[model samples]
Target chain A: MTRVVVDREVCMSAGVCEMEAPAVFELDADGVLQVGEPTDLAAVEGAVRACPTGALQLVD
Target chain B: MSTPTLDAIDLSERTFWGAPPEQRHAVFDLLRRESPFAFFAEPQVPYIPVGPGYHAVTRYADVEAISSQPALFASGSGAVSIADMPPDLNEFYGSLISMDDPRHGKIRRIVAKAFTPRVLENLVGNVQAVADDVVARARRTAEAGDGTIDVVADLAAPIPLRVICDMMGIPEADRAMVLQQSTVILSGGDPELVEDEEYMVTAFLKAGELLAGLMERLAAERLERPADDLTTALVTTEVDGERLSHQEIASFFILLLVAGNETTRNAISQGVLALSEHPAERDRWAADPGLTRTAVEEVVRWTSPITWMRRTATRDVELSGQHFPAGSKFLLFYAAANRDPAVFADPHRFDLSRDPNPHVGFGSRGPHFCLGAHLARREIGVAFRAFADHLPDLEVCGEPARLQSSFVNGLKRLPARLTGVR
Candidate 1:
């Protein structure tokens, strides 16, 4: 199983993560962070790296 | 164009145009601490009464929230400036940036189709070449003079102007005029740029006409002879089986030319000033080419180039604990939020290595986040890298001459030295 988490305190909500992996990350119209379970670990990691805030993390 | 001195003016005046740092930062700092959400009246315009006033959203979270909910805090009402723009100007000036979803989304997607990842990745080589040429010219001037150099003109301004021209396929003969008109438009009523206080309006109108005419010509040329450029891409790309008309292409050109040229140039000019003030960080960036990336990010954060944009409340909405009635105008102060202590540690310090740096210098999230961010970042990074490689020990030679507007946090002049290289 794979899980994702966000630290809202640091999240600027730039939404780069969403662009990298929209399936796993859902930033709202205003740019709130919403993480979903990902079937594709590669895409999830891409988002984790893309996040300027480092707000996204994946744990197995 | 006439700016009241900070000492002589009323502190409660609630104006940001050309105010000194002590006064300008005071309001932003106060708003971030006490009234993170508050209302202030727009400065009185010359001809007719414009905006009634606007609620400021200062906190980082509040900016994010407002940006996310564009539907609630709509952009169409007045996206260009806080002053209510006359309808004709609004339609002419407003492109994807000022529209709502469906339309905004569609236009952005069609535009995005032109800016493919490969095109951007390909631009890196071309961007670096431009950076090299820019620095070479600057070095020649520095070595010949008393090391006196106007970084804003000799160094910073050329990079973006060249890139935008290259990207848009603008004719070389017309590039000089486009730059001249844009400078006047974004100069923000500086007496040096505009004839008088009232001429600012006409200046912008004339500038708009100049750029629109240039774009329409380019659009027509690109259609006749499709080149490997954004103009050709804009004309050819179809959305839902519909292509962009000549007018839509011109609108995008106006948006891209102004936004692209001004933001990156200001960022570069301001970045030079910041680095000169913080030499240790400058040395750090110069020592390692890899550090240029982060340094560029820090500069963009430090100088929120686009300043603030206005959004109208579609319905009665509460933001940052303040109740805003429907039709209320909300100003998202990216310049303020970029420095909020809650988000950035030691918010005022110019730290190049600031991790988790999510400054909205490019404007925050939402469908309207800056489309040229990738290209802008590349421009800043490469330009700074070349500066470091050639003029590694540049120091401030004089005080910066700032632009006269609240909208673009621009540096009109920056005097610097090439140090030993001179």
Candidate 2:
């Protein structure tokens, strides 16, 4: 299983991860994104590729 | 353009770029009416209360004064809105935008070696090739009639992204990722697109990590086999006999990415919009390709894409009779300054022949003048020339979608149709 980690403090909220991997990285009411369980590896890669801040990481 | 008294004007509710059409028209009307100077006080802050330090200068002369004298009005404190910065991330990414002289001069000199006019001229050939390819692709799509192109997407966005990536020695496979990162980083203030701060921060950090890794590898590679690319140059070069740390180098790369991408993108979009709005100007360039250079400058001036930069005062400073106490933040409005009627006759009109055009579209004068301006000029010139030669019949197919962010508001979706492609 692949897992995702996000350093929340540095996010400028540009929304690239949510754009690329919506299923895995969903934004809550506070507009903070989290990696849900059963993360999609391809989508996670897309998220990683899409992120401008480099705030997202994958753990396999 | 006569100067206005303080009692005559006020800051409008709308963010300059994101203002509604009527409000937009009204704002410019007020600008023209008020002439050189207008005072703007900040409304309630959103996330954190931006102290009463928020004030604005909308006149060209006032902006010129502030920008020219970086000693009086410093840019090193930070350029973005204060409310947006998180506490922890403030000190880490130190780019040229936040540096004062001596240090600013030293780093600027070393980095300047990479972006010299000669280097920019050399990069012109590559810029032309990439621009031609992009315009050709757009032309082909536009030739299909209903195949209207989004100038922002098809032409404006990719060319700069590709050129900067190429200059940095980023791999072809990674260009898409680079583009993605550029968009995310550049669009930080856009409310519509950027919804998740945590995700954005996480993504931002990850990009830094990835690029830092890339920089480390590139540094090693350059040590073994130096190349002509900027990455190799930066890795090898030193400022004041001190080599740039990995962190500083990454910050520099990140700065180039932001500066190069959005500014050039807006220049292309805004240039297209200008020409489309003025078919005669379009025909002028289409007829005489030589005018593309002048046209690019005029478009940059008219668009004023990066808009204003915020500077925090270190001591009580008197600018054009306005007293800003130490720690007061002043937003230097470059867009309005670019359109100052006293400086340019018929300021709003896009005249290609306007020479002696000392427009401060690239951040007025001294300290924070855009480092990537030469490359930006080349990219805009190349892109416009290619478009003029190829997509002569291009027309806006739909209302261009506006990016919501005030920091770098530009056309996000510029749908267009074209003809005359064989």
Candidate 3:
């Protein structure tokens, strides 16, 4: 299983992560990055890479 | 195949600007219900013969599919509007949006270097300072004369325009001219900006030329005398040991000045309008400042600025039972998608706490997604915060004079009182 970590300080809520992996990551109502239990590593990596702010990270 | 509901939609040249959102939404709903993917022949103007129209992608899923699959549904042809841009205009005026894969990727990579995370972080304070200044200026205007602030010119418009100019290292003297030209470029046959349809294309072409020339001069200036600004950074910065040429820099500047400026301005102005309309949501947001982020997102969704972007089909494709040929155009209706009742509950209701809102307001589905999205969101949040804190009673003093352009869901003049009026 993989977990998504976000650098809250700089997360501009571009929503790229949510778009790339809507099932695994979301910019919540409070504008914080909320991670989902994503089984797909490809989708997770794509989200992390797509983030313009480089705020999203993947952890095992 | 013709459906009665599809026939009800009046998507003509006159339908975009000045036509209320209700009418637009009605058409969108009908399209989504009857023809989620259907042929759309734009209403013809006098001098302009109707081109082979487009496939209107109305549903959220179809829009996502089209936007995500840029290869199949390409952007380089007619990026912003319904009409196909001439090759010269596509190369020059289209800039980032006008190119397909190889070119789009190259330009995006180069431009992304200038708009780094550090640059975005720095924009926070700049946006805040500009927001505060704008609010103060609006307050004074309100106090000076019956407590009314035209939020578009006085509040929303100034911040984005000034910030974009500031970011690009444009002198204060030339910012006004840049704003004027970009306005004309996107005026969309509005009489206030141009005479009529006959001169619309000419007006767009001339505006693009003027901005390109101005930016060429600025790029030269930055090359000679480097400064701590985006323009200077773009002129000097390299990505993978590749630097942008003068033309690319100029075109990128045009995109920023035109699309970037208008998006934030409309989001903020319409945001104010949304709050005014939904007093309950407004009160909730004002009462609890923590929801500013949610409020900002709601505002963007409500406004849905930059309604649609055109994509040219590269090959024969099928979406939601509609077949599109290789050369056919597709107009992704983001405004309709944002308001898709299938995705959102009570889509029209302005709920500040609407969670899990994957709205395409800033268009995050593809490479052409707004590069300035984060900055725009922050500006909206910060501007709203300024009003909530500084003027707790702030509300719309009069109905906004909506801009007569379909491309941008905008307000030309938003009569607002920083202090809520009786």
Q: State model 3's lDDT.
A: 0.76
lDDT values for all models: 0.77, 0.69, 0.76
State what share of the real interface contacts each candidate retains: 0.00, 0.00, 0.00
Ranking by lDDT, best first?
A: 1, 3, 2
Clashes of each: 2, 19, 2
> What is the TM-score of chain A, computed separately for every candidate?
0.85, 0.80, 0.83
**TM-score order of candidates, best first?**
1, 3, 2
Model 2: per-residue Cα lDDT over B12-131, one tens digit each: 343545653335434655664554344455544334445554666667777777776767777676776533255334433437777777677667656655664555657888998998
State which candidate, 2 or 3, has the greater DockQ: 3
Q: Across residues B307-330, which tens digit of lDDT does each residue of candidate 1 receive?
A: 888789899998656687898887
The number of the candidate with the highest DockQ is 1
What value does DockQ give for candidate 1?
Answer: 0.10
Model 2 segments beyond 4 Å from truth?
Answer: A1-60, B1-16, B20-22, B28-49, B84-88, B91-94, B142-145, B197-217
lDDT of 1 by residue, A1-60 (tens): 778878765565455666567677765533356677786788888778666545677777
Q: Model 2: how far is B292 from its true place, Å?
A: 2.5
Question: Against the true structure, what is each candidate's TM-score?
Answer: 0.87, 0.78, 0.86
Q: Chain B, candidate 2: TM?
A: 0.88
RMSD of each: 5.5, 17.3, 5.8
CAPRI-style grade of the A/B interface in model 1: incorrect
DockQ values, each candidate:
0.10, 0.01, 0.09
